[model samples]
Target chain A: MEADELLVLVAAGDQKAFEDLYGLVSGPVFGLVRRVVRDPAQSEEVAQEVLLELWRSAARYDPGRGTALAWVLTLAHRRAVDRVRSARAAGERELRMARRANGPAFDQVAEEVEAGLEREWVRRCLDRLTALQRQSVTLAYYDGYTYREVAERLSLPLGTVKTRMRDGLTRLRDCLGGVA
Target chain B: MTGFFRRGDLHSLAAPYALDALEPPEHKRFEKHLKRCDSCPAEVRALREDAVRLAWSTAAPAPAALRDRVLTAVRTTPQEPAPVRPEPLPRARPERSPSRGRRSPFAPFLIPLASTTAAAALVVAALFGVQASRAQDELAQERAQAREIAHVLAAPDARSTAGRDAEGQGIAVVASASRRAAVVTGSGLGTPAGERVHQLWLMRPEGKPRSLGLLAGDTPLVATGLGTNAISLAVTIEPAGGSPQPTTAPVVQLALKSVGFGE
Candidate 1:
């Protein structure tokens, strides 16, 4: 069944439909959260919360806006940002990054990143950026650095950094070529 | 330039929100704009799908134990019945329930349900319940037997299709060494078939497989799990009510994924 139909059933308390919905969307939900949370344990936690929310608020989906996948990705993105933006951001984020970046347990994630840098759509979009734009975008996003931090790290003027980040994202949106 | 907010500025600001790089104040401004902005939601979605792809660069082959843990958590947690949220259409009609049709004459008389028809109904319900309970016991026995057969045939290193079958199929597919066992079709699986339904049993050792359930649709779905090493599985062409044993040749044989074998 289509996601909208399945969601309708889920609202009606159909457990099987819920399970089926999970199978369909789990990959995207887990994949997106995994990148930002940067820790398998925390990523799993965030993914679970996102899914539970999806189940609870399934009635809120508006298909007129986008595909079911897009609606779900939006939810996943919001929740992931929340987890990373928690008050304990610095310590917890650093710890999580350290585990994934240095620990043997996260070898899989690191290796995937190294290999995936070539194939990811965002990465491809990044390629369309001017050199400084790419760096500005990366520092601000994947590394979770702010514009000021990105400027300091890149040794560029703050305005220049912000401009590059902005320009880079515009180019990315155009390159990916979606509803916008 | 509506209300002094230029299109160019809104367009530029939206990217930061999409990338999740916006600060709280900026994020709120965009959220407010998003309600009026047709393009921003789409941009965010495109950005998120891209975000997901970027996220995959950070794949962690899910831990082996993760599945078990997650499945357990999902299974055990009493999920609040998800409220059916239909796709938003402006003022869509309220959906009617299947039972919204004519009420049985018994319904009004039993408004408070004078405990009698409800009692007869309970008895009728109980009659089926008793049958279902008996079937469950039989299913348990069948599963145990299948486990035994699986044990006998399974190599010491075998990952006997025990919990996996039950877990995945939402039913117990346990087995034993006797080439006999029972299956408890999980409630997650479908309900019992109507009048005439399904019949199941062992169909290995070259003889006819034994009959397990009728229409096999009853709760726990009249399942009797079996191992290939123990016995072959085949559905029988029985009446909708099902027979005590195989009264006919096997009708449908289940090709288990190499049951009674090593993982």
Candidate 2:
């Protein structure tokens, strides 16, 4: 069954369907959170939280909103971003950045991403963006930087960073052919 | 993040918001914008789909035994009840439906509690600069006010607008039509000269203006029971204990657009 179908069953409290849904989604959830959060142990904790949230909020899923997969991933991404932005993690993030000489936050994580067809397609789409646009999106999404932080890290003006983020996502949306 | 984004260009924040790239304050502010911007929800949904694709591009497998940890925990975890959807309105208007059990009017706003807590902490920290030596009672009162400010900013239907007072002090208003509440914060507002106070009023299209309350310097002022007909927020100087109505012309009048109905 598709994830949408399984999610509906999960909403109805079918344990088996939830197991199936987890099997289908856990990889992407863990990967996405890990990409943003960086630390493996912390990533696992956040991934578990996202999965539990999915279980707890299954009934809140609205098919009219977007796909079940998109909803799940959005929850995961938001959770990861929140983790990175929290006060506790802020100090650790600073240390990590200093150690890495403040390079684009994606280098290590990007290399380790599984070479799946989806990964290749996304990379191709991302490659089409201008350097500044790609940097703006990745630094924010993958590295979990706020757009303002992205601007400061890139030494670009706030307005320019905001524009690049919007334009980058717009181009990516068109290039990805409207995934929803 | 509050005063920097022009009201006309808030829709531009949609993409960053969808990608989870905004700071909490900006995130809350943008969310309030989203509720009244008719086309924004669809735009955000589509952009989020794109973001989800970016998530999928990095699908590394989870640890082998972690699956059991998660599945086992799920067995004991009770699920949350789905939110009750409000009946569809014929036109855009403030939406109010309980997401869970009926909440008391004074209960802390609960839906976005985590982010609101963080934002409120920031507000409290900002207050600490000038309020550190204040009495404990005043500290408690200010904390509550900070929470109220955070609540209004964090409301799902909150919308923000900014204007300048006569002295060029920046005034920001974040209003939630669903909650019938608004929070007014100003930068560089001057203390009124002897025996007078700065006052806030909610200006309605037809009725007499309703007093919100006295504004003390730059402390955020929260006003509840905002009428749907409220057209703008006005601030004026009133004699000491505040007045039944404004005796002076508004030094700052911010037109409140995009509160509930689409612009």
Candidate 3:
């Protein structure tokens, strides 16, 4: 069933539909969360929270806003980023640990050559972006860094990071239009 | 369009907002703009669909156990009611004044209007007074709970340890040796089934475990009256109000000493 239809059932408190939706979206949600939170244990915790939230707030899902997958993944990403940001704010020790244990930085060429055909296509589309554009997009989206943090990391002006992200995502949208 | 957002600036935020890249304040402002703007919502929807492709690129199989956990949670957790669209408040019609251009024939009857108005005002005031007192009581209870957690966390002899369940769910215990009080904070444990709850137990070096308390919701379970001789902490699903002895296998367990308290 399409996610929208399943979500409609989910909104009506349909357990079967919710299970189907969970099966459909849990992998991407977990994977996206794992990329940001990094810790296996913490990632799972955050993923569970995100899914439970999806269940509780199913009625709040507006089909007109976006696709169910996009909605769920977006919620997952936000929660993961919130976890990382809160951990960083907890102490310098946490920030230092997170930095030391940080996942691989976004590397377009390396990623392209390493993945299967599907991911390879994504990587190639990402490669179409300029170095700065890709960096800005990757740091903010995948790394879960805010625009201010992205600016600081890349040593670019805040306005520049914002523009790069906007332009870069637009370019990516057009390039991945066929795939999406 | 105002100082909050320059002309066309909301358009640029569509991508970042879609990707969850904007900070909270900017995100809120852009969302408010989204409600009114003609073109930005479509732009955001398109951007989100594209962003989903990026998310899919990173898809790795979720842990095997997550499926059961999620399914169980869906089955057990109560679904929230669909939000009722609030009806806009009725605008007040202009009130006819007794001293207006044309006084109604009943004007004399409203001569005691001052007294009647005073009585209605007293009733409204009394209702508000009761509501305020009730709110204050709830606030006091919350404050007391916060103070208790703070006292436990701030104790000089406080020690803490954290570990994960088999499914990589986090559980942490913080206890003060002198006070014999502890708090168990767990993440990723679903709400227990009907008439059942996650129960915290303090296991002695030998013999059966003793119940600390039945955990409620996701809040940290603050348990007191602990014996210093208890060697470890464990959690299990048990009948509501708890059991003298655990009826089910422990979902997670951790040694108290591992949290760094010296004997």
Clashes per candidate, residues 3 or more apart or on different chains: 36, 1, 0
| Candidate 1 vs 3: which has more lDDT | 3
lDDT of 3 by residue, B1-263 (tens): 12477757766777677667777777767776765776665456556656666776666567888888988877789987866651111101122222111112332222232233322233234334433555666867655655666676666555555555447554566666557787676656778879888888776422356777776544566677765444456678888788887777667656553232211
Off by over 4 Å in 3: A92-116, B1-5, B85-263
Model 3 chain B is weakest, by summed lDDT over 10 consecutive residues, at B86-95
How much of the true A–B contact set does each candidate keep? 0.18, 0.55, 0.43
Of the two candidates 2 and 3, the one with more favorable lDDT, higher being better, is 2
Q: Cα miss at B159, model 3 (Å)?
A: 65
Scoring the B chain of model 2 against the true B chain gives a TM-score of: 0.49
Q: Write the per-residue lDDT of candidate 2 for residues A1-180, one digit (tens) a residue.
A: 556678788888888999988987898899899998888889999999999888887877765454566778888988888888783354654525442423334456666766243454467668778888888888888878888787887889877888888888888765543312
Error of 2 at B179 (Å): 47
Cα deviation of B160, candidate 1, in Å: 51
- DockQ versus reference, model 1: 0.09
TM-score of each: 0.47, 0.57, 0.54
What interface RMSD does every candidate have? 14.9, 15.3, 20.6
Interface Cα RMSD of candidate 1: 14.9
Error of 1 at B44 (Å): 4.5
